[model samples]
Target chain A: MSQYIPRKLTRLPADYCFPAEGDVAAYLFSEEAVIAVEVALVTQRPLLVAGPPGCGKSRLAETVAAVLQWNFLHQTITSRSRVEQLTVDVDHLRRLNDAQRAARPEARTKARALERDEEYYNPGIFWWAFNPTSASRRGLPANVGRPRVAARCGGVVRRPDNQPQHTVLLIDEIDKAEPDLPNDLLEPLDRRSFGLPDGRTLTADPAQELLTIITTNRERELPQAFLRRCVSLLLREPERDGLIAIARVHEPKVAPELIERIADRMVELRQQRVDSGQRSPGTSEFLDAVRTCHDLAISVDSEKWQQVERATLLKPMVAQDEPSRRP
Target chain B: MSPAGGRRGEIHLGELISALAGLDCDDAAQAATIAACLGFGLRAPDLAATGAATPAIYDHNRALPPPAARRSAIPHPPGLALPASSPAVEALPAQIVPSQLASVGVLPSTDSSAAPAWLVAGYQRLASERSSPPRQTLFPERAARGVLTAALARWRPGDAGADLDLDALVRCIVRRRLPQCLPRLPSMTLDNGCQLLLDYSESMVPWWEDLRELARQVSGVLGAERTSIFDFAASPAGARRWRADREAIETWQPEPGRPILVATDFGIRGEPPCDLRGSGWPAFVDRCAARDCPLLILIPWSRFFWPKNLGLHPQLVHWHPATSAALLRRQRGLGHRTAR
Candidate 1:
């Protein structure tokens, strides 16, 4: 039997905004990246995305979560980040304070009774993704009364009368982490279950597999073993049409012609930088330049437009050896 | 004792007895004693006897300090002394007051050109500065990114667009270009000790300062204690250990078991470097091998200025415009290998 389950293509809600940035809406994904995401979903493996900086690698997870209506958990990987931080961390200081309060003679009787409770234990994203009620029961400040409930059916999270919510774990900048970190994720990625430092095992429901997306800028080489467990895709700089589409998503109010011109100029500038052995500008820079032009009402041929281009598109102090001669 | 006082004392005595009994785990007896302490008509024989035995509980009321004595014992905060008299205020002249401020220059004059010429000139200068855009100095990491992305085209293996490991290429570009954009060196610590030898000869005059800065950055990243610096001319005879604020040339000697980094433009004035030709190159390589020290040649020249014979040396590593100390520290092993 084929492992892939049929999932209806759900159009994003018109008013849907990414959880991280409430003002920005999800951008249209390229056909190739969409297929790669689908393959990752069907296989129930982490999607490892390799790309240049600001190429929408991190935003891919947020877009996916928004479209699927799944809870998004983002963690930016740094060199000092430890594996335990991804699971859970006990608030020892708070617990110690409680202990001290309990020993006080004038302490309230009720307050002393609650000192031994689990309120002092801080739950990480994995804890919430696996057992949503654990957060509600612990009376975590983040989740006070109402608990998040959604059903995970065939790797997609759907709203149900009463069911567990699925989560999308975004491991961003995985290359910045220690070499062993990718390998260390083997057990968690394979079993979809990890034991907390507190000795409690958090296992995902077999029916609803947790979706994970990892992004890398190719700063460091990830171990082969870890790569084997993931479905990887390289997100190259999109083609001209794709770049225009992205720009439109960022500034839909701008004229399409103007956006196209900006995108084309950005592409040319990137090519020039490439030829000169310099790094090329990414989609974010293109979006910024377009937005600045639109806000300032600066025409492409105007003198002030050159200032905007310099401020956003080109690196400073590097002489534009050749003037933009394009009419 | 008065009847009311006697009754109140008896109740207190009974309550204390009940607490003691409760501590002893006599639940039934404790409850009965509590009921008797409530002054109910029921007078249990055991309650009366317990109350009598616990006369010390009634002693609490007797031991209380008299109200007058307690009030006198209560400590009071020290009183703050107020100033004896307020100083007389010196009033400003009536003409200087806001109501009579016609002489004061609080408001703009009717004549717009009343301002001093220098003040007007300064305002004009400020306005001109504000109108003009500031010079752009690209962020080091951003510039590094630009170089890496551009270099990607060259590193791309085929049209399939499969994810390629560009870690080495990225290190090369970042190690070369970062020094130009970064004002200061990045601090890092390396496990293995190394020495940095810079080419300070005449031919490298153009890139001398930049190469020296790169060396200092590399030293900081690799750790200063473990990393040493030296200067070399065209020949081994011109090699000398680097001393701060000094140009004295001494006999060159290699530290055993430590890696050596030679930053140069690979150009020798008048004649080619002695080590690049004849048995001198082989002999130098043998000496480095004998001491178990890896020799890394860093050519601090941009890709545009790359010479045709750059790749001839087995230990030579060409520096690009995007080089950074972090990348150097990361690619130390590759630096030890032959430059391709």
Candidate 2:
């Protein structure tokens, strides 16, 4: 039997700003990238994206999640993350106890034993999504009882409620996580089902059609094994038009002239710094300058120009002195 | 050299100029007086009494005194007049402050057969093999970005020249030194340790499934387990999780013979804490551990940390196929622009 997932659910909260259609394909490699991702989704391949810092690597995942209306799961990596930390094990015993108390008060003793077993072998978030029972069909047979209820960090998923047929997993900054951690996902990610502890396998049969999107800042060399599994797409520093669109999104009140000035300056600064000594300002720095100028009501006069220029240029130059001097 | 040494040299030239210009007075007298004061090199030549003068003549008929032929503290004896027609050296630019010319000095000429003394000393260092690179002239934006990125790109092994923060470090390293030519690959390995864990499997599904039930159980268990267990979940769970991850707290070691971590490198200790140590562990360890196999899960924990600590991300250490191509394209464009 097929599971029912709520289709075309509105993802963005009411107050959130949706990306304007005109600017949708403006970012570098954005149009082709979206096409690449769409193809990956159709073919069921995890999308791997690589780029420099100012390049919008993370946004691809966010955009895919936004466009597809899939529930987005974002996990940022750190030096401290472990396996269980990323995909948590569920607390099955407590779930059974609560289920027992609410429904079958007469079978309290038997329910208690089940509760202990559940506690002993609780599944994590990975197990819940990987398990078939978690995504049980809409109409269950009478003997099965109400479908299993799984707990999660975001919210609980009632097995009886519509199972999320499509999920967009965004692994932002995958380069930061432990080198070995990425390879672990190969088997379960490929098989679309993971085995749980109680000899009960969690299978998303027909399966959880996951659109996995992994982003890396290209800070280090990724293992070849991980790179081979996914369709890799790269995001570069946006071109003039793309940058203008990005600036518009962030600073709605920004004047066209100011946006162009900032974009031009940013591109020039990045290019020169890289040429001078590999020292380019990031998008954040440019925006911060724009906001600062906006806040203080300052214009780029010769003196005040130094203020913005110093923030963007001189300081980074001084900081990067030795490197620039190198052969 | 003594600070007063230049004054000594100046006094001799001052007297000579005064004598040749025929403006003999206190300035000229003072040179003699100072010579007297310093003792030696003070005797005046008898030719001064006859007032014989010649306009900077260079032929053998009136050859000038070789500045090096005599070293009587000053280049010439105090009373002798220099040739009247000697060319006056125009005063150096006032803009060149003394401090700015701190390296000013004289060098002995190797080709003394033809070269002048001043030229020998002035051009020595400038012509030396080891002068610093010329200052770059870049547009402001280019200076800000390209120069900065290029500065970051220069980092080599053992150059710990910074105490930069995360943002500064990434701006310095990743953005600056990024290879201009990214490789053209059918596929490219991400050249970095910065990773992301996109858990697409719906975090909310587990949340909706069990939060109420878990909360109810916790509420009930509070009486039996006491508040301490729940407190454990609250207080140090994050920290404990971090520590446990490092300590391999969850690894199930059934017996003594099983190797937990394989490769051992004590030398890797001083590097960033995240640097992987036991890379070649047995596969049995993977089976035994409750955690996912370390190979498959990619998390971007190293983002700012690598740039801050190591200056460059580990992934970009080698050239991946596509990155090499991208870098090549960038470099080619740069080369063309430069050629023009």
State residue B279's C-alpha deviation in candidate 1, in Å.
Answer: 19
* Residue ranges of candidate 2 with Cα displaced over 4 Å: A1-29, A88-117, A120-150, A155-164, A308-327, B1-340
Q: What is every candidate's C-alpha DockQ against the true complex, given to 2 decimals?
A: 0.01, 0.01
For candidate 2, lDDT tens digit of each residue in A65-111?
65665555667775334454443343433443465464666756655
Tens-digit per-residue lDDT, A109-217, candidate 1: 7363243334655555555555555543433334353322221212223446276576788888876654346666666666666765456666655544467899887
> Model 1 - which docking category?
incorrect
lDDT of 1 by residue, B33-101 (tens): 323323332532221011000001101122333335344566667898667576889888778535743
Judged by TM-score, which candidate is best? 1
- How high is the lDDT of residue A85 in model 1? 59
